[model samples]
Target chain A: MEFKKYSKTLFFGATLAVLAGCGGNDAVTQDDVNASTDGQVQPVITSDGSNGDSAVNGEQLGQEAQNLQDQASSAIAALPEVETVYFDFDTSVIRDDSREVLDLHVAYLNANPAQNVVLEGHADERGTREYNNALGERRGNAVKNYFMVQGVSADRIEVISYGEEKPAVIGHNNAAWSKNRRVEIKY
Target chain B: MPFKKWIKAAAFTLLCVTQQAVADLTIEITQGNDRATPVAVVPFAWLGQSPLPEDVAQIVSDDLERSGLIRPLSRSDMLSLPSQKSEIYFRDWSLLKQDYLLIGQVRPSVSPGVLTIQFELYDVVRQTRVLGEVISGKVSELRSRAHYISDKVFEHLTGIEGAFSTRLAYVTMRKDEAGQNKYELKVADADGRREKSILTTYKPILSPSWSPDAQHLAYVSFETGRPGIFIQNVYSGKRRQLTAFKGLNGAPSWSPDGEKLAVVLSKDGNPELYVIDLNTYKMKRLTKHYAIDTEPEWSPDGERIMFTSSRSGGPQIYQLDLVSGETERLTFEGNYNARARFSPDGTEIYFVHQKDGIFHIAAQELANNRLRILTQTPLDESPSVSPNGSMLIYATQEGSRGYLGAVSVNGQIRYRLPSQRADVREPAWSPFLTN
Candidate 1:
């Protein structure tokens, strides 16, 4: 498990550097590729375990890279365009208005077996910071449990609450706070 | 023509003399009771030494009345307005049921811009002056000087430090012409007077927490297009950005020792509580829960941290001991409880408790595990105890607009300060005044 984790970290570093180098109009500059490899990618690989057998390292790195790519593609394909699920003030119970958005997430999760998503809960600035944080987590868990009941694996869905720390709207009025209390699904 | 010029000068001097006479006089009350100290504030007599810029007597009277502890006997009730304690007759005041009397006069200072206010607080019952002192300040600061005199007199009699000199920091949000939200951080006198905006931004600003020293304020601002923590000095107006991490950087709480700050950061893909050393900017992750862990407030002793975590299947307040690495749940009476703050004595934790579908500020005694609701407001949040732990301030909504409110620690004497300019929220009481 330790070896697998190290290999996966190295693969992620390399892929990030390559992606940075690939964004160009000119024939990929040697400096761009070299900079990506030397300045960015090589450090991460060396830190993970460069003294290990290079052949085994390379094969493991390849397998981890393929798995990450598959996960990325699956996540993209399973993405539901729904941006957020709104809730009433001081409430964690998902409303009818947010039910359609949750349904889309449920369908997306069922269609993509390898994909999992985390729900980020948020609240408006109406209450105290600590109360809003708790309220946010409740909203996130509400969405997570709904997805689990719809046949999505419990292990695939995670819930985290941001509370009133982040708001979609900054208004002090009810209109702003109402829009701010919400849950966003991230894959 | 030369004689006419001298006459014009004489008229100007006469006009100034009357204004000076009206402003130089002041009054001081030396004795009072819990049932509103009744004292007569006589208008000061000008010695005609120099021109005064303000009505010192009225200023002193206003200060005493606003304290809610003293009631200045109306001038209409005064048998006579005497300018000096020697001129006041104890028998006349005794007939009027006045318990005390104040008399003073202002004179020219040695410096050009300064004035010396000599005052005496007299006990009408004893027929003697109980306190006598001369205070000097610039003419421009005459009102503040009067407030200081009131504070001294109140403390001498009541034995409680007067809060007249303190200020309250509150957030005000308003909608602007472009239909966008505007937020302002305002500091006002304890009586909600002399308001001044400390910081104004188009981005949202939340959680304005004052440092223990009262020189700086730490708050969460989205001005950089993300929720980040920024500390700004209230006096110097210099601000330092503490965190702008990629994902989430919100809820910055200062430690009791003022060496570290416990904040919520989500850079590692999940929101968790982390303590950052302000000096080195190094962070030690405190909670590893995949569930959200945020709103970290330090215990008074700095040995433990109280925060909100949803790991127990729902949101609840938990305390984490730094030395033992032990975690204990603190709230179980409600479905949701968060935003806990320790009292000044560290005996109880005050937080927002949601029970019976209404949210209120509730206090839980750590020793007995007893919970008591300290507020009647339906949506009270952000319960911040006073430096002395005598009162708690929080924000609650009335209709659609939010207002800042305060209640005594025993849950009596509740009052709300509703903003006419904008909706108010997130009130942070400053630490006790150093001076």
Candidate 2:
């Protein structure tokens, strides 16, 4: 294992950027094939493996509207408060630690009636994904209910559940799950 | 505690080594491998001047071994290797205690880039040839042709149609150059060969459901910074977005007829079941509940839809009658039984069942409700049954990364298709595919 890592690093000294894309299933280039068999190493892919596996980039296809999200982020950053709330496992009920953050967002929404927020709900990488979506949306709805009870109008808030798909941090332990089961107060 | 920590560390290091050493798909039989029928698959004699791309007989042997019902004898144990009936000595194979013997020879076909494999399967004790055929295809198709032969031999011996000739649709994730998680939707042969990327993005793709026709795949893609259902043609790579609702538009399951999809949409404040017509784009809500109703799948007969709903105070599967609108709760043993799938015959149901906090794939008969856990792995979900209803493939995690695992329907045989680098998930095994 140590020898493989060292060999890979040496071969990819200047091609490290391209090495990442080689992880793709059929996206390996002729250069990657050459590198894999460089030191008389056995070739992995079939000899007839094609090099035409270019993927459809979703960002480039529909980026006319999403390009402004970072600007929206800066606006939220100007508020100087917590913009995320988390939940315990399998439960959507808001916790006490999240109360202060939820209240801060409520106050901001109240002060800026024109500022609309999308509560993007998320869950840890556990359980079935679609069920987690529901689990996630329940958390989002909990936040939406709390915000509305604190005087934010229903029209000013939207909710969506990504379930376990998108993670703020990537890992499979409690440290990551505790942070992943969250609802981001997206602008 | 120290012993447990050491074991965990050892397992982690082993997985890292596996990830580095494996190139494509390496089959791992995890459990219940002791009672398989022992057989022999002699290497096919090759006549080509150049080395062929793949090992044909080894692929056939691997496919049979993956079923966990047939075990191939080691080549070293064979007293003599034979490529034709004239060269075979039945007493030699019987001495090795192999119940069945397979022999084949590959010859370059008259057509350039094509090869013909003539194979024969013999019953050792019976001293007679049971199956024989010749398959010819392009050089790149050697793996698939091997699977076809495996299917034929498996069916003739077991009386069950082999799923080896099918395809698998799955999602793979790896970090791109920018150090961002890039996800890809791909399709490949059942043995994890001939993988073709269908879509790629930095966002996540989930719940890849194959159309009944096996020509298209419907999945939830979060490419636009939001979830939407999209259908892509398997061969052409052309896709069209089916939904762009305000909230969650996920879990697109096709009805038996392939004309409509049972989807979960939160367009109206709460996630609910909706039947969306493919041709007219007409959407009809099927379930109305405030407690998160999602993961709607159509029954094989198309008379009812099974979905997961939290209305019963926990995530459990519920069956909804399409004609009467009456709902019946099917699972009562587990607090979390979701992502339910109907067996092809509609006699049983398979799902993700939580037990002692670890999710495992389970099946329950409809008549007697004899519930049985089919998989032993942890965090197993999205149980996609083979069209033959004999086995299933699901998503499971090892360490921090995910891999696709498979098990026979009876919970006896187990295997996994571990990827070399990608975090593979949501594997939907295609039906018996067309040429």
Question: What is every candidate's C-alpha DockQ against the true complex, given to 2 decimals?
Answer: 0.07, 0.11
* Cα lDDT for residue A8, candidate 2: 33
lDDT string for model 2 (B195-280, tens) is 77889998889999999889999999999888889999999988998887767789999999999998887664556778877877
State the lDDT of candidate 1 residue by residue for B1-435, as single tens digits.
Answer: 211111111110111122121221111222222456787777666665555755677666765654445667877788888878657888999898887788888877889877788888888899988878988888777766766777677676667666555667778787899977788887765545556678999877888888887778888877876567888888888998888664457778889888888887655434567777777766776775534577888998999999886655456899998888787899998877888999987899999888886779999999998999987768788888777566677888776577877765765334456666577888887786665
TM-score of chain B of each: 0.81, 0.93
Candidate 1: DockQ?
0.07
What is the clash count for each candidate, in the order shown? 3, 0
How many clashes in candidate 2? 0
